[model samples]
Target: MAFRSFGSVDLSPSECYDMLVNVVTPRPIALVSTVSADGMQNLAPFSYFQLGGTSPPSLMISPTLSPEGTEKDTLVNVSATREFVVNIVTREMVEEMNITSVRVGPTEDEWKLACFTPIASDIVRPPRVAESPVHLECTVFKIIRHGDGPSASNYVIGEVVRFHVDDAMLEGQMMLAEKLHTVGRLGGDNYIDTGVPERFRLARPSTPLSRQ
Candidate 1:
């Protein structure tokens, strides 16, 4: 196979970002919702997200700096109140979630714009998305910043305080992935449907192998 390699230092931030997103296939989307101190709702979708750990059940979402070199609304709100909610996006909610991605003023209500019902959360000030299959109520653990200007990224790490799973999506104690119909991010204006019939399970090797 023929391949081309480019040095990281040789590419612009935008160039690197475009390439990286394509290389990192099928990233999970985090539909994060937060509330300002004055009770304004802010919701946005972030593909640069992951569950950080199991011990404390941490969730991390990285919001890249805006074109004007400012932090995103979700970052600002979480900084002020230190609380937020992660609503797992499903196939049915993708269109509404995309509506929330529109750049709007701080006073704007994304829930209303997206036509999503805001349900009262058990612990967080920010309401959970009623349509979402899973809700993770979190308290800010830490905000780690990287780089400056266009290359900047803010990593908001949160500890999951409460987890709400829809009854229909659960099979015994496990959440069925197919029933959830989760969607994932791809490069550019692309996404992947995880509930398709392509899923398979692999068991880890039973015997440990000796190091060469």
Candidate 2:
């Protein structure tokens, strides 16, 4: 079950997109919530987000261009306001979160259609989804737009201003991982729980090893 030739399976973007989602096991789903200049709320889900830093905290989210090659509302708002929230979707809210992923006009509020409560944020104008287990408020400091196509993505680097976590979900000073039960994206419509075994720490090698 291996491709020995490194360059043999030259995957097209479409093929890569499919295989990555399918074979990469599971990817973290970032159900991003943002607000436009006019205060209209927008919601979209992307598996392209990852934690970037710890000191003062930061997050990196990629908002890909739409099929028509224009910036999506999430990208425009992130660029204009330089702010957004990364809502962590759990098992309970999967359906509602998926509903928010439906494409709509910039003037529309996906929150309403999804029938979820939008609560006020502390430092950012964009609100957080009340149903989400965790919410991270962020202010964009950089945008890396890729490709020349109309639908090119913007790799946004955002600084965390505040983190909202449900008190009930915490066990003492640590987060109760089993209780969180976060959902992740797989290839196509498939998904897997963030149910990785236990957290383990591995010691770093004291000396660098020479390459063969």
Candidate 3:
């Protein structure tokens, strides 16, 4: 099989990003919202998002610096206020979510452009996306920066303080994946739906017994 060694290829930052996004398969999208110190609200989608773990219900969203080497409003707001909300995007809300991905001035509001209703979060200053099926109100645990250019990343680590799930998508404590229909980010303009056709569950194996 043909293989491309990233280190040996000497790819540009954009090329590396393209390859990483394409090779990562489907990644969960985080529609993160934050409030500036002056109360300006910011919302944007980050595909480089992952769950830290369930023990403390943490989440990490890696936001890159803008082309001008400036921090994105989401990261700036998060740094100032140390709070944000992560709204899960569903298939039905893909269009609206995409609207928020547009690059706008730091003072501009994506909620207005996206036409998504912003509901007040219980503990966080940033509002949650009302159209999203799930919202996680989080407090910034830390911000770890990597690299030193426009392509550099700021890892926003947030601890989920409160979780809100739509009633129709929940059965007791379990969230129905089909009902949620969450959209995942693929390479470029591609996206995937979290439906039964693309989902499967595997039981974890128990630890091996010790040999006598």
Candidate 4:
């Protein structure tokens, strides 16, 4: 067998990013929405997202600073209002979600740009994407800054205050994944359709398994 390895410090930011995203494989998309202090609404999609914990029902999204070292509108609005909504991206909204990822002026409304219908959120000022099947209304629990330069990240830790799910995608209180048809991000200009027919499941071991 042969292999190649290089120190992370030796790789440029772009190269590091490429390697990370390529290997991460099908990261869940968080279509985050926020409202600026002045009431300007902002919407964006991020794949650097995951569930933090369930004790307080927390989730996190890491928004990286632009190469020019400017904060993204989503980060700016989230910092100001201390609230945002994470709308789950499904196959039906994939194109619009991609559109929202485009760079636009802070004042520009990606909701309108993507032709998405915005419905009022229950507790947060930021509206939820009506087209999305699942919406997690979150309040900022904490903001952790990693670095203060280009490609730096701001990890927004949010508590899910409320959850809104489409009735069609729900079986009582449980959400049916097959019905949701969620989409996931891959390395640049690529995405994985999780709604595809192919799927398999593995049952967890009741006790520790012996090594072969």
Relative to the true structure, candidate 3 has a C-alpha RMSD (angstroms) of: 12.1
Best by TM-score: 4
* Candidate 3 pairs with clashing backbones: none
The estimated TM-scores of all candidates read 0.90, 0.85, 0.89, 0.91
Q: Output the lDDT of residue 145, model 1.
A: 92
Q: Write the per-residue lDDT of candidate 4 for residues 1-212, one digit (tens) a residue.
A: 79899899999988999999989977899999999999999899999999989999999999999878888888888999999999999877777787787777776777987899999999999999999989999999999989899989899999999999999988899878778788777777677778884333322223222221
Give the poorly placed runs of model 1, Cα more than 4 Å off: 197-212
Look at candidate 4 and give me any clashing residue pairs: none
* Candidate 1, poorest ten consecutive residues by summed lDDT: 203-212
1-212, model 3: which lDDT tens digit per residue?
Answer: 99746682598888888989988978999999998999998889998899889989998998898877888888888999999999998878877787787777776678998899999999888999999989999999999999888868999999999999999988899987667777777776777777633533222223232111
lDDT for model 2: 0.79
Candidate numbers, best TM-score first, in rank order: 4, 1, 3, 2
Q: Of the candidates numbered 2 and 3, which has the greater lDDT value?
A: 3
What are the per-residue Cα lDDT tens digits for candidate 2 across 1-212? 97654342486666656756677756687889898887788888777888888986988988788666778778999898889999998877878877777777787677887898989999999889999989999998899988756546689999988988899889776888777878777667767666553322222222222211
Q: Give the distance in Å from residue 180's predicted Cα in candidate 4 to where it truly belongs.
A: 1.3
- Candidate 3 lDDT at 27 equals 91
Give lDDT for model 3. 0.84
RMSD of each: 11.4, 11.6, 12.1, 11.2
